[model samples]
Target: MTRPGVSAFSVLGVCALIGLAGCFGPPAPAPTGTAAPTSTASPTASATSTASPTAPSSPSVAPTATATVPPPSSAPADPTPTGEPTFTGFPEQVARLTVYYVAIGDNGVSGPMIGCGDSLVATSTAPVRFTDQVGPSIGALLANKSRDVGLSGLVNALYQSDLTYLGGELAGSTITIYLSGQFMLGGVCDVPRAKAQLEYTAMAASGATSAEVFVNGRPIDEVLSLK
Candidate 1:
């Protein structure tokens, strides 16, 4: 009776044991029990280091920046200054005064000058400034640089020369003057004008009736009387 069921035993035969793999397609590989998918461990850096090494650091500049705008002015600015510049107690500081120059009509030989000049022909001038009354006045006279080309017909004598006024003494309507430095003249034309201009200018400024001028050490009358 056991022999009679042996045909059914063929149906229970294992597919791997038999060589007919085509019968059940290729036999599924034996399950090696897939080592429990070796627990996928993430990299240590992912958990330990939050920021990536390549990430940019905080900036040195402030996070938020703002601009300040100035308020508009109500009054307009003045372009020019109001007052004149002042320099106190300096030689160059200006002091206004009236001064005299030579007369042009004289032609040098014109009969000895009287009053201010042989001919009292007056005009205007952008005259120099001085400190004292007589000394500085004479200094201004020596320093006179401009020539009047107008109808006033006034001229200067001994100007631009090294002739410097040392000092002067005013006593009893008479002035004694001291001078040092180069004594030069414009020429024969300036001869008489020289004597008149210097002498009279000193007289006018000092209220001296007479002026005695000495150059170097000797009196001008003795050394150089442009007479």
Candidate 2:
């Protein structure tokens, strides 16, 4: 007996479909030139191509110039007193004598030396004994004055004697200082004393020297002259 919907052709068609299914079941073989994916640089190469370039390095800094220092200068030396004083107007009798003198007071001060209207004067008893010759007398007097004025020591005993004798005998002698002209004390108070220095120069031939010096119309310890 024949089935109601079945046919011989339909049975043959079903067999053909099953055969086609077997043929499609397995995948086709890979291409001959291709290889399996590996954990290599392919991905990294792609990322690098996309990234930006790095910045350039900065230049090295140069050192600054140092300042130059100058050498020190040589300074001049300071001056000092030589202790050698200058004396002039020496008498021929004492050709090489250097004389200086100062007047002193009871207060240990050297002077309150007063001037006459225009001149300075100092008085003293003859300290040196004389042999009548003015040369020796003047020499002794000058030597005494020099010592009393400033010179001292045993070598200058004559000066000490002169000072002592002058102090003892002529202490009361009025000494006057003469100036070239009259001076005003002004109105300022507290003025006490002044000093005068006399210097002499000679050719070592004169027998004696006068102690008098003139300034203006006044006689000073030494004369202030224009000649």
Candidate 3:
């Protein structure tokens, strides 16, 4: 009986320690010496040990996975620039004013025109009025003359066209030239006032026989002779 009492005391002490460590709810009263534990043992021990192991393993595996992540990529390079457009060398006698033909739809007729002047007045016709210049730099002159309207559109157009025209006269062997000038007349329509820089290319070096000239899309014959 004393041995049994001593054995029960030792079991109670061990159970108290387990309860303090949160391993068990409370100590149970000792049963008969030959009796088995009413609670489970194998499953409780396995769950406690495995629970902590999986938590620490998750952190270790996470860092290893993140370390293998790929780096970001680089961007592409810029494109190369193109060379500027320019004339090789313009001849001295190429720019000038002469009586040129004015095509008005169905009928084409020759008219008196100042070499550098943009406006062409009808010599003999109805609806005779000074309107927009109908030659190269026509849009520019219109834009310049009509400061009221604003030539920003024309300036932009010329910048995009890449080619421009000026007025000139054949003086002996060389050509006498005048740069373009624009002024507002009345209060609205832009008008050409002074000589302007005109551009043209030789159809042939003959310096005679006019070649076809185009402005915007309309065609006329006023090409320059470089010779």
| Span of ten consecutive residues with least summed lDDT in model 3 | 187-196
Residue-wise lDDT of candidate 3 within 94-202, one digit each (tens)? Answer: 2332211122221212322333323332211122122212232233332332212232111111221233444434334443333332221221111111112122222
State each model's CA lDDT, in order.
0.64, 0.34, 0.32
Which of 1 and 3 is ahead in TM-score?
1
Candidate 2's residue-wise lDDT over 48-162, tens digit each?
8569676569867676554455555675466565787886533332223322233332232332233332222233333443322323323443344233343421112123222
Preferred candidate (TM-score higher): 1 or 2: 1
Best by lDDT: 1
Give the 10-residue window scoring lowest on summed lDDT in candidate 2: 162-171
User: Candidate 1, residues 1-227: lDDT per residue as tens digits?
Assistant: 46665565576576445756667676778787764443335456565565545556764775443345556677567556659776463344454444566766664444345533356333333554655567876776677655553445666666655678898887898988888875567666566566666777787767788988888888876655543
**Model 2 residue 207 CA deviation in Å:** 28
Candidate order (TM-score): 1, 3, 2
Top-down lDDT ranking: 1, 2, 3
Worst 10 residues of 1 by lDDT: 116-125
